[model samples]
Target: MVGFNGKSNSAKQIIHRMRRGPTLPDGGVNFECHCVSHLVASPCGYEFREAIKCQKAASEGELEEGACADELMNFMRCAIRTECFRSW
Candidate 1:
């Protein structure tokens, strides 16, 4: 079964299979960023949004406090690899 972070032997196998052949959905990691200048200006809203993303990423095995999206993705990749290795 896939873990909370969505990583598992099956997940690895699926990724490998997808890499070997083209398939529907054109799968790979996709990221979305929301920019709310108005909300960021508010102290409570800024804290709330940041907290939500931090918690979500934490639950998904991503490192907290990434300075940028690229850093966050890299952190998640490393975290997933580390978890996989530990499981083995």
Candidate 2:
């Protein structure tokens, strides 16, 4: 996502930084960074990574669309959770 100065940062970096924040009483964590989008995106980072792996497998012909169904759903769910349509 774009930083305050309009520079782009990796999803992994954003997610990691956000996850470093303190855990709340409600079993949630608060982020320390100023990237508001990351706050929402962090929770879905694992799913995003899984989706990437699935895509890579598909691109290499090691996986088919049908095989990627679960990964695709997970990716979509994470995207929805983060409200980050461009989560990748």
Find the candidate with the highest lDDT and give its number: 2
Over 4 Å off, model 1: 1-35, 60-88
Error of 1 at 49 (Å): 4.3
Q: What's the TM for model 2?
A: 0.38
| lDDT per residue as tens, model 2, 3-75 | 7779898999778755663443453433333443343356676675566556554654555437677877987
lDDT of 2 at 36: 37
Q: Which stretch of 10 consecutive residues in model 2 shows the poorest summed lDDT?
A: 28-37
lDDT of 1: 0.44
Encode model 1's per-residue lDDT on 1-88: one tens digit a residue: 5756777668677665445422224542112212333333443443434544554446343443443455445445654554533433
True-structure RMSD, every candidate: 16.8, 13.9
Off by over 4 Å in 2: 1-41, 59-65, 85-88
lDDT of 2 at 3: 75
